[model samples]
Target: MKRLRDSWLTFVKKLPRAYSGRPMAFAVLLGLSALNFCSEWPQGIPRPAWIDTYDRILPDSFGSARQLLFDHFQRWFPRVPASQPVIIVAIDDKTLAAAGQWPWPRNRLANLIDAIAAQKPLAIGLDIYMPEADQTSPDKVAGNLPASAAALAAGLRALPSHEAILARSLRAAPSVLGAAASAHATADTSTDLRSAPILVHGTDPLESVLRFDYVLASLPELQAAAHGQAMLNVALEQGTVRRVPLIMGLGNKLVPGMPVEMLRVATASPLVEVFAYPSGVQAVGVADVQVPTQPNGEIWLHFASIRATQNRYVSAVDVMQRKAGAERMRNKLVLVGLTGTGLTDIRATPLGELVPGIEVQAQVIETIFDGRFLQRPAWLKLGESLFIIAFGMLIIWYVPRTDSRLAVFIRAVPKSSAILGIALNLLLLLSCVLVFRYFGLLIDAASIFIIESVVMGSFFSTALLEDEAQKRQDAAREQVRNSGKTGAGKVFDGALARWKRIHRSSK
Candidate 1:
């Protein structure tokens, strides 16, 4: 037992001294890399503010650069022509100009639906919400009338309400109404208004889905009449819409989003299936279409360019006036929403354009059909941390050991202390870009570059300080040796030896 204790103590004592000089710097690099790995822990310690800022700025800035490259690729690459039959029926300035003004009466909307239904569209999703009864209805108007107008008011009330007309139209066609999920709770807890059943394939599925305390759904009459209702809310990051959720949780029930609901109706799938794992919801399947999403069931949309002459849009006025050709509208999923400036539905996309919110939804559906959604693999973070550690150690090992002559040769053109370091980092960045371009994978190498640069800089600074200290020590030793050979040094040395002998005798 004593021997074992002594051995343990010896190991602990030797641990610190084991790392010295270049090895000590390498040890510090490994320690920093370990911290980097811990920073990514799911329920780990909170990172410092500067680290958080570094993470936020570096990746987003690099992402913007990558987005530009992707834009150029889209322009130059030979992409498979998109053939998904999805169209946005935008209520733009032209549409509003031709179809009266904003908030056209529900009856007129009903007329529009009737026209679209005649074309046999696979599904009609109303991105616009009718939360309350239309104010222009006869009942609302008759209430403020004079008592003497009772007969006239009663006659007006006998006519069908606009809500009823729109509801009836919804029942006649394959329609899905838009609803929104709220972070705050409301007094209403009616579960009967839910439109779809959420099926869980794994344990604790609700924990992984985005939970909402309240839902602002369509009126009961409209919701009941429609084939299904889907949430219109989208997830935003830094006040910008980057990802769209496919499923949301209200209490224990999971609800579909507009695009997913539209796909359900189009595919004639009776139920939307959500697959879950211990981590979170994995993928959502609607009939034959399976969409893999983030743990929260949101997809990072790979946006395609919107061309003016493309079949991406058909003006609402054209649809209403029966001007849209049958060949274009038939068997297509149509999203109806306002795109006029004052509508406030504009969203900033990764493609660096402001498009209608409904257009974002259309893009998501198109991405799914095209099977070209961008994905960051689950193993990427682990792979990146390991790479940073290995590469950082390599830099620490290479920078100080690099021959001065070789460094001078490399620095001949640029004349920088970190010429090799800069070249290696650029190489790392280029490799990342190539991976993204070829494999559609987004690996964040910014952190690795930052770590390597810091480590290499420290290594060189230490080497420089050590060199200066060695020169000072060498100069002091040479001065002592010269004084020893001089006459004044010999006399002083003899006197010092006599004083040392007397002091030793007194002790």
Candidate 2:
């Protein structure tokens, strides 16, 4: 037992000393790297209060720069030249002017649906919600009539109302109506509504989605007539809509987003399948089309910014008037929504443009069809953490050693370490941008960049302080040697030496 203890003690003594004995510059760099890593450790990890400041600040500050780089890449890259399979029927100023004011009579909208359906489009998604019956309907008009007109009112009320007319159109066509999911819950208002079945193919699907308690659904009459219903609510992060949710959980039921619902209806898929792993939702599949998404069943939309003159928008009036060619509409999914400024449906995108909400959904559908999705895989965080650790250690070891040698060889060379470190960090950032542009991979390197800067700053500061101390020591030694040649000088030197010894002892 004594021999084993002695051997262990000898091995422990041979091990390298702790960080306390290392140069202050290296120690500071090491400490800074650790702090940075802890701040960036995956969101799943529990963190201290101080780390939350970094968590909040880094993303808010760096996210804009990342978005700017993404926009630059988008502008430079050659976009896919194929025809877009999705078309947006925008209710713009022209449409509103031609078809009368906002909320045109439901009977007129019924006629519009019939005209678009004649083009043999795959499906139509109504981004507008009709939560109440048309006020101009015969029933409403009859109720407002006086007794003197009762006989005439009776005949008019007997005719099918405008609500009934629109319902008939919805039943006749492939249509998915929009509903909204709200954060606030109301009383049992959804009792009359029937939610679509959400099937989880794997275990623990509930944890993989964003949950809402209340759904502001379409009118019951419209819901009953539509082929499918979906939530039109967008999920925003920091007030920006960079991603669109494919699925969401409302009460105990999982519901499809508007675009996904339209796709399902067009494909005749009965059930929307949400594939899950222990971590979170892996993908969402409608019929044969499978879409990769983040854990919350949301996709990072690679927005194809359609400018004002981009011909992607077919004015709703043209569609209603049958002025749009059948060749342009055939087999394409149509999204009907308002793009007029009065509607306030505009959303901010990474492209720095405020586009209509329907355009965002249209882009998501386009992304799925083109198989070009922006993804940050589950493994990327781990890979980034390892990268930071490896590079940080290299700087801590390399900088101090190289600074001294470079200083001796050429004084100007030592100053270049800061520039070199910054350049390397910029290169890493550019690589991230390139990977995102060409490969659609998002790797965050902000934390790593910050740590490298700190390391380089520490190196320069430590070198300067050490250099100054060495010059002071050399001057003091020279004065002591000169003092030995004279009596009065020797007395002054003895006093100085005593004071220096006392200072050293005190330290």
Candidate 3:
């Protein structure tokens, strides 16, 4: 075992040690920055999961961390409540208990719409879709009955379909049906399902817009009767709703989101205007409201505080029962969607709240009405990338000089000096919060500082370890030489002593 240990150490000593120099470290930062910048696609195309995973380990300011950073700021400081009256009519536990099971006969839903419309709301948005017919209708229920009930089944079929009833209510009200986008879906054969006309201001952005193969629109009868249709499919990042695409592609057709369509219905705008270039979409205009968005046709969602949200909802049962008065919904955009237990319409928000999907739509409406938006335009992303790269290069140039002046030959940095890096990271995070709070500009400086700091620390740490190894080798060689000289002196002295003894004996 001892021989093996010595042999291993000797073999390792003979091997050459590569330097973790400034240039090598610089390459790491540059690669990380490039990977981050490339991962961004303003056209709403999906990137692979691993790309995001790696960026979390080593980040550029403009990559995955940007959203998380903004989320953190939002958590720390509550946004000012919006003055726009956007109310969500929630179909919660209480409503379900009163309304019986889901897929409730379409007649009940039609009644809900008529009741809300009677309140004279600005617009009515339905967050649910009926891709299939109501199986609970009278004809369908009687079809399964025994043959003896043939007369009963015939009578049931003769009655008006639950679908026609719903269609009538939709036509009477200013209603927008919410549809979901999918890669595999067959849209209903209703041309009325189409979005308002989209007018492009710049080069064609069709190729760059976020795309789905098709949409799961409402039933043909309902679609024909509804005033408008909007895609409820929003852009999700890390299971959270941060940005919402104002417009998205449905196969060859373009559709607006639920909130924007509600605005169109409310304002009676027949056209939606888009400003986009080959790079990406910039802003979307409908009616008199213009909203800034990310390159991918998405606008950042500024959520309302929980306290304020408390007043935004009225029980679905209350609306249906007429217990909640028209004053609650008058002149307001009312969004209707299910939020009951066993329902799948829940969504996560950056505020760390799990809210019904309908609430998300309502917030978007409020954001549009407030006319305050979070803008992280393409140029800002570029600026952030350039700034990080430049700062890293400056540090690469300056760190060594400063370090060398402080230490003899740029020795391993003292542990205490790490405090400065931590401080810098904290300060950057604080600055990002402030910028978002006051200027509505998001800057993820922490990602840049973290990436640079890690590279900087790694370079110095490797140097320190290798320098220690070198010192050990030199000390071992010096000891070996001194021991050999001492042994040689002993041998010479012994030989002289033996010669003197022999000479004295002979005399």
**lDDT for each candidate structure:** 0.74, 0.75, 0.79
Number of the candidate with higher TM-score, 1 or 3: 3
Instruction: Write model 2 residue lDDT over 418-479, tens digit each, in one string.
Output: 56656787898789878877898867666667666665566656556566767989999999
Clashing pairs in 2: none
Model 3 TM-score (2 dp): 0.83
Return the clash pairs for model 3, or none.
Answer: none
Q: Of the candidates shown, which would achieve the greatest TM-score relative to the real structure?
A: 3
Off by over 4 Å in 1: 1-81, 185-193, 308-310, 402-419, 467-507
Cα-lDDT of candidate 1: 0.74
Query: What TM-score fits each model?
Result: 0.79, 0.81, 0.83
**For model 3, how does the per-residue alpha-carbon lDDT over 1-507 read when each residue is reduced to its tens digit?**
999999999865543233335666687778877765765632343456776776677554454566777787778765676585788888888999998868678999999999999999989999998988888787888888899999999888888889988999999999999888877644453333556788888867777678877677888778889999898987788788888889998767667888878888999899888888767787888888888777678888878766677788888899989999759999989998888898846788888988888888888887787766877776776777888788888767666564465444334555545666777778877777788888888776756766688667756765676799889989999898767777778798799999999999999
Q: What lDDT score goes with residue 482 in model 1?
A: 77
Shift in Å, residue 300, candidate 3: 2.0
Which run of 10 residues does model 3 get worst, by summed lDDT? Answer: 12-21
**lDDT of each residue in 309-377, candidate 1, tens digit only:** 146778888888888887777898988888876984778765566677887788778778878766654
Using lDDT as the measure, name the better of candidate 1 and candidate 2.
Answer: 2
